[model samples]
Target: MALRSVKFMTRPFQHNSNRSIEIFLGTMNEGNYLNVGLGGSTQTIHPDDAKRLRDELIKLYPLALAPAAAPASKFKAGDKVTYKAIVGYGARGMDGRKGVIKDVLANEWYMVNFTGGPFDNLIKVHSDYLAAQPVEPRGFKVGDKVRRTTGQSKGVVMTVVETHPTQARGDIRVDGMTGWRMQKYFELVTDDPVEAVKAAIPTVNSGRYLVVALEGANYVPGSKPKVHVTDIGANAEAERLAKEVGGTFHVFKATFEASREKPVIPPVKTTKL
Candidate 1:
């Protein structure tokens, strides 16, 4: 297996325009996202699209452009979203797109979904690129996951609205919607392996001894470890702790380095084998 490192992608650069694209791979979320940068503007997109675009864009020229920063918003999930970007000399070219909010991503970028049809070009976008739209309850198919926007149901796995098969869909206003909310928070997740690290133990000098509180006289379950000190005070503290926890006390003499030290258990050499 190959060791994984932080991977970054430069979205097919077109030096012809003043814009460039750069992205970083991150799992700072349950879902893997790309830290997408459009020239000075930044946002995030899915990792799969990032890889797909990377392979296709490599043949393009490198655009040496510095990324500009932008802030994410307090916008809730499932909101109607509109944004525009100078996609830089691509087939779609510079244009504005409309879609639904997917998820609240790190660094303020939101995952945008244009999953169907002509608007599907956009994946993620910064708030600066986003245009505001009114919040309204809309009709959606059953078995579709939706997010709660307000009230006690906020952020909870919501009990979605009941819709009739003939229920027409759009931004149309509906009456008597006692407990319904509009949809648009991203709810998908992707898993990645986490790296584990060991904790480092501190060292004590030669004259010191490491003290530990034992659960039993024979160390069946080592209760706790106390300070590694040279003074009798450490032994006293260990004894008191052991007693309080219904355990026993034990100590190890310090070696040239306490880290290399072992217990002072002794045996009488009355006979040699």
Candidate 2:
């Protein structure tokens, strides 16, 4: 009797998205006449069986196809945004995840604090994966009691010290709180309020510097009088100390002459008495 052999070929489906695809192949024997053993190498698959395998494989092609979605944007350090996962790539209940803006990284991505967890586990999402959430003000006045939304001692407003744009350092009192008795610190609040204050603050000139003026001394001619410095901080410490101890402290300007510069020479007498 002659033996029949067959070969099967399969191709994977391709999609427009940047994702991986896989293909699988299988064979079966129909004729029991040829006592086919597992190691005999005479495995045969009927033509109908091959067509059924191709159809089953095609059913899985849709699973490999990813939906068309936008790419993530380049996020910055302080941008408030939200996100939603692309279908077939995210959890069933986590279609739309909301979180506070925290950090941004290279490859056009940023982080959002969805579960209030450590930075490492925070969602590192692409720009197109997130949407900006509308920030609603917490109904607390400048002096109203409000705690830090996030940080070491979260939710303990202690006191509402001040609110400013970009940064808001609140003086929080944590004397009675458990595990936070000694944690007296400030909260750095960011967002629109702080940003507004920052914008309103005047810009200071960087080139200008502060200078201390020297004290001037009073002196009388001929008499050895104690000199007093009217202005104190302007001169050196030793000069100030000397003036305090009855020594004259003189103010020297480029064009000004010192009172002690000229010594008194008595007039010479030529006539004999």
Error of 2 at 35 (Å): 99
Query: Candidate 1's C-alpha lDDT?
Result: 0.54
Q: Model 1 off-target regions past 4 Å?
A: 1-72, 86-94, 115-122, 136-273
List the candidates' TM-scores in order: 0.21, 0.22
Residue clash pairs of candidate 1: 40-68, 77-184, 77-185, 78-183, 78-184, 78-185, 102-186
Scored against the true structure, residue 92 in model 1 reaches a CA lDDT of 55
Candidate topping lDDT: 1
- Tens-digit lDDT track of model 2 for 32-147: 32222232344345666556655997887745767777556456567766667786775445445567658867677666667533332466677767777677644333444333
Query: Roughly what TM-score does model 1 have, to 2 decimal places?
Result: 0.21
RMSD of 1: 30.0
- C-alpha root-mean-square deviation, each candidate: 30.0, 21.5
- Model 1: weakest 10-residue lDDT segment is 194-203
